[model samples]
Target: MNNISSISNPIRAPRAAFLGSNLHHHHHRLTILPRRPNVVVCSSSVSTPTSPSLSVAQEANRIGSLSQVSGVLGCQWGDEGKGKLVDILAHHFDIVARCQNEREAVKLFHEIKGATPNHVTYTTLIDGYCTINDLEEALRLCKVMEAKGLYPGVVTYNSILRKLCEEGRIRDANKLLHEMSERKVVPDNGGANAGHTIYNAEGKKFALHLVPSGILNEDTLCVIGNGVVVHLPGLFEEIDGLESNGVSCEGRILVSDRAHLLFDFHQEVDGLREFELAKSFIGTTKRGIGPCYSSKVIRNGIRVGDLRHMDTFPQKLDVLLLDAASRFQGFNYGTEMLREEVEKYKRYAERLEPFIADTVHVMNDAILENKKILVEGGQATMLDIDFGTYPFVTSSSPSAGGICTGLGIAPRVVGDLIGVVKAYTTRVGSGPFPTEILGQGGDLLRFAGQEFGTTTGRPRRCGWLDIVALKYSCQINGFSSLNLTKLDVLSDLPEIRLGVSYKHINGTPIKSFPADLRLLEQLKASGISYEVLPGWKSDISSIRNYADLPLAARTYVERIEELCGVPVHYIGIGPGRDALIVK
Candidate 1:
């Protein structure tokens, strides 16, 4: 097998050849890749198992090492036949992964191989519109991909780069690079800390000061991470009447099976009189919202919708939870103390009662009322169950489409998708991020952004705006408008810089976003190529209009508009809801 080289060849020729001469002058430099390559059958080294089955342990091992190699197959451009390679390789692998690339990668992978529909793992779909450049078709396909949950990866970047180069968009290219840098986004690649202690007057929140007087509150630190460190300072100014709900402990909580019985009892009363009685003890974390649905699927769970058939619902839940508890008991709990703590949560379940309702009915009524509801996503797009970075992704979809699944709403009612993005990109868990900044700067972004996990409270992985990745992300989410938050963080800086396309990765041109971690690490290690912009000293927090802000901030926003190809519907000057400039 030929080992793919870590280095890519840079185009030594003039821009004319990069886009083929077969087209008009505007698109002459674009490289249109060949769709799919023929499959070459490779002999398998391992003998087929005679039993056609394996032990649970063996199955786990098989799935864990699904991909034989540690690296990814990449091309200089999109049509490098990666899909064909993935299809060919899937025979030896358990799953194929795609992100920040076109959805075709997965579609082609399965199409060519005739894999079962169940075998393919489709994740997030992103939409893009180069309507200004007549690339709306590509963007539309991206939305379809998003609906199906197949994420774009490096190919998306390569295709866009090829498109820009073909259009002879040198100025736009530079601007794109500039926006990418400030946002810390790589053109084709998509890809936190502690403090001095100060508390709000409410004592519910604390701040950390690294600089001598940089104001180290938790909220400010959440925006950025690193700077000079200081020892425990005296009690700082507090916000009047703030409630401190900070965490100081961790353990598991268990719930009992009898919790479902309360709903059944309520059903018997018809008016939920009993259900109302138990509502006080529900102790529901609301996270169990999914668990109720899971019970219905197995025909062993109780749902309020099934309350009309309470006799069946309670019996089913009782059987399932008991079986679950019995199985859980046999499993080793390592420490007795841990087991006891878990039982405590389980015991708490008895005190609570759940309501039985056909949530589907509630949703249908909402539709009838024609109400405008904004479904709050529990997590970021990166943690989405399907499109996210695989096993690392969350168990549920949090993207726009998640609204349909989570709430059982018809997709037709969904209108005007608005995407909320920070000035810089952030991800909570592990995944391939091609443009992560390291060392002092990364630490700085972390400290400044207070980049901690909102749910996990663990530190987040911070980087510049990854246009390549964000493009894919926005496309999947069908973003009609963007609310860009935190442009003011760049305020007071000596000079603000944004990432552009890289000159090379490991001595080679970064023609595409490389997936190999070793190469990616090296590409990131090469540091970033920044397009510096003058910083503004004015406080943008008070500015309400786009044109009314300082020229520098306007220039920054305009430059971003040009690169993203999407208008900034709203620019956030501060964290508060009112701190927005709607253009």
Candidate 2:
């Protein structure tokens, strides 16, 4: 346990290796951590659970971060007793202040939520990139800053030149020196050239006038969360691929800054856990989703913001990787392993920084501005954390109620719950599906619908639409409208089936969709009651309106609407963007 520190305060003091530059000093000593180094960051000493003093919305509004342009920025969003210090002094300053080094500067920068960057931010980042000898990225960022009309100040130019000279790249250094002289920008105390210092030169490229502006009303903003790893570019591409439906959401997406970052290590842990620990194979996506959420619940999760301010990432990641390494006996891992993860995560964090924002603020501000905001959930109600089948559920809450909990939007504003149900039911991985069509029928529907996990590519188990489960979901989620997908998958079949009720092996009908996993499994094993409908063999993919659907299709949907007690507002006929038929 030589390297073991308490789990409660596990930010290892920066070692001597980081001392010469910005990060080696001042790791705060807090309460004693676990001797075995628990990756979780909660107090082991406390016997009682403490209630939240403020809502997440309130806490988000209070915590803000101004981007560091020229100096060390703002705050660290964590424990270790440092936040209290910032909370007390943040209100006292009008101007963004400087710190001794880049660490404190970025801390200040990240403390404010919506603060924009200027010349100072550009300079600090440029210097940081130069420090790591990542001059290429630094130079690229510098070019971007200039393109955005923020001129690099003297310190900015000076730092790059100095680094070049140190590396003995005298030609590049001389080229920069020539540029500074030509642009009439002075070097610090004439260090680079003979006359006049650029230190006093005015940064006139950006405007500085402050004025009161009215609140801005924005369009509908969509947020995608839960059970899946982040794929930002793919997200926009998917949105673009989705038919506009007379309304487009191809604009600004406010991602939750609080969402956990899924790492490659998580995926490794998931596959290994199922293989070695589980009594039976519970098919998982092995996307690291479960492990990531486990870390989140234990309060050791790394967020999207951690990606932007990566100075303390190693400290946090060290605990995570170390915990994982020690937990699994079959895995090969250590300091070198941890170091590799750190570099990999650093790149991920950098790539993810631009999209990170306080979604709580965005939600609140959107309401204040009277904007239409839509929070998109990833999974269905059957996978909900509280109501869904336990030990067989997704790691996150995916029901309508999860929108408020996950997005930090207050409950009062949550309205208009919409449920999306496939015409034929399908599920990936191991879960007790009561109405599953196990033979050739299941295979046909699975192929027709392309029922497979997008990321894992695992074939999904297909079945009839489960009305027993649908009614239960409706009871819990309170759907105002339904978006029925893959209606076309049911086409050309001689008959369509809907699971209406479940009966036990003893010939007694069950009251409702069973929450008990054992009973659910038994219910699936015993077979459930279904109402059959005649299938329409005609292709309806080209149908644009619900009324134009075949009589059989209309009857099938109408029966679902009748039974589930909700309007099917939108129906999917095919896989294409324009394949939907709106009611």
Candidate 3:
């Protein structure tokens, strides 16, 4: 004799007996005692030779009763024999079709005899676990399903991925995405201070500041790595612009949770600091990169992950705002201001939920999984804070070393470092440029190369290629090859010059780039040594192969390779994507 259990609802029925027993061959009848109108009975049973069972029509009627049950189950009654009900249902249905508020039902479903759970059954339980925010159990079910030779499909993976991302468990989500065979990540190491201009296949130009160039590719994942200081408004503006231009950016972009947030107040502080310096100001884009990095180094900066906890976000943001307010009198900070900023960030936090990720884990995991990754460095080595000319440098490291620190990948994983240099040199702001052309000569090169800042729209100071700086940069970055761009810019010139060496005011040869700004000034004033080469004079932009280049152009390219000791592997003749020549 099988024992039937009593289900008691505290609010409705004092005692309700749920009765079901074997009636005839492979048939059973269910009867509810006390006849409570609100009482819902959902059950299933399979027949053995000696055990109780339900007929096909009776089982259909019982399963149809599920429509009367609420979509979300609240198992309020204590010890309602949910495990027994799940066990009874497991053998007859593909999906258990009920979410009991306890894990015992799910565990029992797995242990039931002759109850083989398929992908749908596992996915249903996993979705239920995710709904309860029990991700551990959900992941365990995934492993169990895989162990039983049932591969979890996109639905199963999406349930877990959504929960992990919502909880800001980006590393776990990234690992799961890798398991789903979604690979390829492009990481940006620099801030908005540097800009990259890329032309697509159709000659459509994109001016990218905070975003990586890989955004054009649909399959690539673009990561604004930890070394970057993100300006949320600017980042969204870029995304909105891209989306408007038919580029879908929903899942392809990710901002590192560890990256520092750049507030509008930081931009205000940047202008104030630049004003104080007056003429000696670092020719920054006034994008607040320096001030934001200052806050990060000083340990008072807020991170992207801080957006997740809005309860404490106000306090953390207040600290940053107050710090800026105290330093710059022009900076305005008040309770009203804080309130407004908090409200604005509340909206930003909601919008940024999908883009925030643990890029450190994403990058390292990509490396470990042997997935191809591209690390796009923003600023040139000449603008690097440590190696570049002091006082005129950007706030972050733009060298190869920045790759490891910025993306949180091991140094051993970094492959061929390609150094991209223009055939002619250009500088945007105030810097000790040894090879700068001061007169109409620079004006000619400026017009020829279209030398203008992509972000600031300022005319870049034009000059001859500085081999001294190139060699120094090559040594520092350990570049395996070089990409010489804009070779077509020198087509009209009768001759081209390379700043081969530097000399002192006292007629002595300077061995390497001088760290002393005063010495740099002296060398620039005294005129550097130049090696003049014959120009190609012909239009090389139409040339597709390296061998197709003119004799003079080949000579010029070979001379640069001989000087820098790095072979030129790629040559960019024009601004289009198809304009590049591979050697």
What TM-score goes with each of the models? 0.45, 0.58, 0.66
Q: By TM-score, rank the candidates, best first.
A: 3, 2, 1
- Backbone clashes in model 3, listed as residue pairs: none
Best by lDDT: 3
The C-alpha lDDT values of all candidates are: 0.37, 0.51, 0.62
Off by over 4 Å in 3: 1-194, 279-284
Backbone clash count, each prediction separately: 66, 29, 0
Q: Which lDDT tens digits does candidate 2 get at residues 1-583?
A: 0121111111122221110111111111122122222121211122121222322222222212211111111101101111112211122212111111010001111212222444444555565455545677678878998898776656678768877988899999999989989888887532211100011012111100000000011222344332234433433333343323222433434445666666777767765664453323233334556787788888887776677777898899888877887888766777888788778767656655555667667566756674434333444566565776555555665565565666566677766555667787765444566677665667688768765433323345677787888888878777776767678878878667667777877868788877766667666554476565667898888776444566668777877887778876556676443455544
- Which of the two candidates, 1 or 3, achieves a greater lDDT against the reference? 3
RMSD of 1: 26.6
lDDT of 3 by residue, 465-552 (tens): 8888889988888887677778899999877777778877776788997897767755555447666666767998887655467766
The TM-score of candidate 2 is 0.58
Better of 1 and 2 by lDDT: 2
Candidate 1, residues 64-178, lDDT tens digits: the string is: 2321211122111111112222222232321121111111111111121222211011111111122123344445554565465544333343344445667787786576456
- What is the TM-score (0 to 1) of candidate 1? 0.45
Could you give the candidate ranking by lDDT, starting with the highest?
A: 3, 2, 1
